[model samples]
Target: MSEQLVEALRGAVGDGHVLTDPDVVEAYAVDWSRRFRGPVLAVVRPADTAEVAAVVSACVTAGVPVLAQGGNTGLVGGSVPGADSAPTVILSTRRLTRLDPVAELAGQVTAGAGVVLADLHRHVRAAGWEYGVDLAARESATVGGTVGTNAGGIRVCCHGMTRAQVVGVEAVLPDGSVISHLGGLPKDNTGYDLTGLLVGSEGTLGVVTAARLRLVRPATGSAVALVGVCDAADALDLVRSSVPRGVRLLAAEIMDAGMLRHVCDVASVPWPLPQQHDHVLLLETESPADGDVAMDLPDDRDVVVALDAADKARFWSYRERAAEATAVLGVPHRFDVSVPMGSWDAFVSDMRARLRGIDEVEEVLVFGHLADGNLHVEVLGPEPEDERADVVVLAAVADHSGSISAEHGVGRAKAAYLALTRSPAEIATMRAIKAALDPHGLFNPGALLPSGPASPSRSS
Candidate 1:
């Protein structure tokens, strides 16, 4: 980076906000993925939307690439910059944390972009309201990042993803212009739903400053159970038999016996898993919204407090610490894939067979939201450079008319296989849209799209 650009940025923001020191720069260079390292010129932490706009305009004029990051907790490498490539400045969103509460005419609370998700949950619950989006990374993940990924969670089947909760958004475009679409439009056939466009664009289209998220009334009662199945086939059958009739299945996460074993060994805690159970299915379902009928529920809310809050959390510790445990085991390649719910069982079987063939693959952990069919597969050790090797699992997932990515965005990690999910026409339209929004390609370049048929391997 040129000294003049640094001086300009220092002039724009105070010396306290602009970090150019090598040690400080290194801290913000990589995201939570730890899959890639970026050589950034500096990381600028702006206080508000105006400051973000000014910094962006400065970077645009300076011909510098600006990589926007929030919480540094994205699974994808969307927040990473190149080390040997042209100077890219990281724009961290941590400093922009703010939550504004509002009540709609229909009576709902909308929050800002920077609010931590778990805090939001507490806030809404205290006020006797609810915002349905829940995820494991609630502590570290920001509301902005969640909205950016349109993040889905354990509650996805009952409510929906982040896209559904967001009624309005206040975003900054690539050109340093603030597009604050805050007013809740009940119905608008006026033009393209720009809010929808920006939601899952992975920061390529724009920066989400704030969002007017939709709210719901709290669930009156809930039931949680660990259903020990004979096998993965039986696990799928339990889902088919139970859900859709009365139970509003909030979550149905599947953990293989190997995963259970790994979790037990890592945490050194006795998991509440059934003996000799091939597959462990942890499910959560809700009772009526009315408090009166909730007590009548087969498993009342106390069951929820006991199982989910205590016993469930004890067992759930294994699931929560899966990422950390796997990191300790060996190098991990996490493939966040999704398919039609109907094909999840078959796809898992096929994937297990393929992975069993690989001598390098020490352990393959399969677990995810079965109702939504978004499976997170972690391959432990041995980096396979072969794209053909990649196709075994990728093709199995694609066989179900599913996506290459469900919650995690298509960053450089999966850019090579992004096309397997979307058609050529769809990808072309996406590229055209990207070119239109970011004419300079200054925002997180070489991500969400492959440079060519073959791309560079990830190195954290």
Candidate 2:
């Protein structure tokens, strides 16, 4: 059966595009965080929407689970196969790199799923526009992957999430039917928005082939400032008080002293501020004039602002290099969650004390977009397979009335804990939608939705 499925995939997408070698397929089987991995019969690369539909159709007929992967940069296990013994094939969308011309008047562009985020940024910037979303993995993160996760980055407070920027999408349904609506309409009173449904579905409902994305005008001039704060509350207050009245706040990020020190040591760069503080708040705003933007800020606290492009980039490195630094230490159990503003400080304090009690926890690093309550928690020393730390962290989030996931979707990593954030009825509704779109349960099974008993015919 595996041989026949491989032959069918080779027929749908060309023979050369199908990879069966263990060495080659291994890379596609693992995820970005290196925590989840599973076996696959073959890896199929589809170049266009037609090929993707054909690949899905073939897999559906053969009763083989199809996992649609774009760049394979997902931190959760959604983009990769699971540990189940069910026969699976990974459909790679790296070759679907079709980028259309930017529509200057409409402020939009259509990009294939395989187009990298960084490349799309450059493409629009050349046209005097910018995409709202920005991430540290921009160079490798693909359009489809970001859409699948509905990624929110530093600019989310200003431009909103990936769902806000996505005007339309082209996707292949579970049964291999293709649905496309890339018109980029400003207001479409369409019924049951399939584009919105697929934006953050985590590939369970369908495979996102391309997206018509909304673009924003580029800022004329920007200034970045790094301010030292005693804690999260002080940082929040400073953000409200500081910055000129007319200037628009572009981004507000926060990092703890421990996380900063680790980033500096790993990146081998000096701390931007003169003295160390418990936490640092990085703010970027549109500059009203040419002179230093930091000068306008009250001189009551330690503040370092950068107007020069090079200095600004250097200052941003401490926050941007955080994930890279954590990866260097080893594979850490990563959690991207959101807590309420009022309970933010208390939640962090509670988590710090709880996680430290665990013997295996070597270090806990916390940082995220301060304007929003999203926090990226990285814990070292727990084995990749260990879920003890996960329980402690996610439980704390639930106790604080916070969500289990913020930007990263509830892939296999957090699927089991979906109940902590979502109600039983909500989960049931989601399951019904999954069943309707994928009755056979062949598209990305065991992701986003929790696992249940396998059916007689299909093993999810």
Candidate 3:
């Protein structure tokens, strides 16, 4: 069966595009965090949507599961196959790099799933527009992967998540049928929003081949400020009081002192502030012609504002280089969760105390978009397979009336604990949708959905 499937894949895409060698397949089998890996019969790279449809058709006929991978930069185990998955073929989207010219009149662009986020940013910026989604992994993260997870980045507070930017999508469903809606219409009022449904489905519904993304006008004269704060609550208060009356708030980020120090050491950059406090708040605001927005901030606490572009980049490096620095400490159990605004500080305090109590938790680093109440938690000192830390952290999130998964999709990491955030009825509806779209379960099985009965609800 493996031989026949390989032959079919080779026929759909060229022989050279289908890789069966163990040495080469290893790179595509594992995820970015080096946590999840599985065996693959072969890796097939398709060039266009038609080719992707053909490949999916072949795999469906062969009774083999297909895992669609795009940049493979996902921290969760969604983009890659699992260790116990059946003989699967990784449908690589790296070759589907069709980027259409920017629709200047509509302020949108249609890009293939394989198009890197950084490249899209450059392409749209050249047309006097911005993509709005900016993250550290922009250089390697692909459009389809970001769309698959509905990624929220630093600019989410300003421009909203990927779902808002996505106007249309072109995908190949589990039955090998193509759905193309790349018109970029502003008002469709269509029956069942298929694009929105697939945006955060995590590849369980279908493989996103291309997307029509809405672009935003570039910000004019921005100023960045790094201020010291006592805690998350203090940071939130500072964000409200610091910005001037007319200045527009673009971003608000918060990080612990320990995490900031680690990032500074790993990046080999000088500390931006004079005195470090327990937590630091980074704010980016729109400036006027004079570019003196930082002058309006209160002088009570330590503040370092960057008016020039170079200085702003330097200040942002501390926040952007955080994930890279955490990776240096080895594979850390990473969790991206969100709590309510009122309970943000208390959740952080409670979560930190709970994590410290764990014997396997050696170090805990916390940082995230402060205004949005999303926190990225990285825990070190646990083996990759040890899930004790997962239970402790996710359970605490449920206890605080928070979501188990925030910007990042459930993937296989938090699928079981999904019931903690979602009710049984919601999970059943998701399953019904899954059955309607993918009855054979060929598109990304064992992801975004729990395998067994939903766990009892724990949310307050």
* Leading candidate by lDDT: 3
Candidate 2 residue spans exceeding 4 A from truth: 289-295, 453-460
Model 2 has an lDDT value of: 0.88
C-alpha root-mean-square deviation, candidate 2: 3.6
Colliding pairs, model 1:
165-214
Model 3 lDDT tens row, 257-294: 88998998998887778986888889998766436674
What lDDT score belongs to each candidate, Candidate 1 first?
A: 0.73, 0.88, 0.89
lDDT of 3 at 405: 85
Clashes of each: 1, 0, 0
Clashes of 3: 0
Candidate 3 Cα RMSD after full superposition onto the native fold (Å): 1.4
**Model 2 worst lDDT run, 10 consecutive residues:** 451-460
User: lDDT of model 1 at residue 438?
Assistant: 90
Ranking by TM-score: 3, 2, 1
Please give the lDDT score at residue 159 for candidate 2: 96
Query: For residues 167-271, could you state the per-residue lDDT of candidate 1 as single tens digits?
Result: 778888889899887777766677788899888777777778888777887667765667666555666677676555765666778887777778888888775
Candidate 1 residue runs with Cα over 4 Å from true position: 82-85, 288-308, 384-391, 453-460
- Candidate 2 structure quality by residue, lDDT tens digits, 336-370: 99999857789999998999888999999899988
> What TM-score fits each model?
0.90, 0.96, 0.97
Query: Model 3: which residue pairs collide?
Result: none
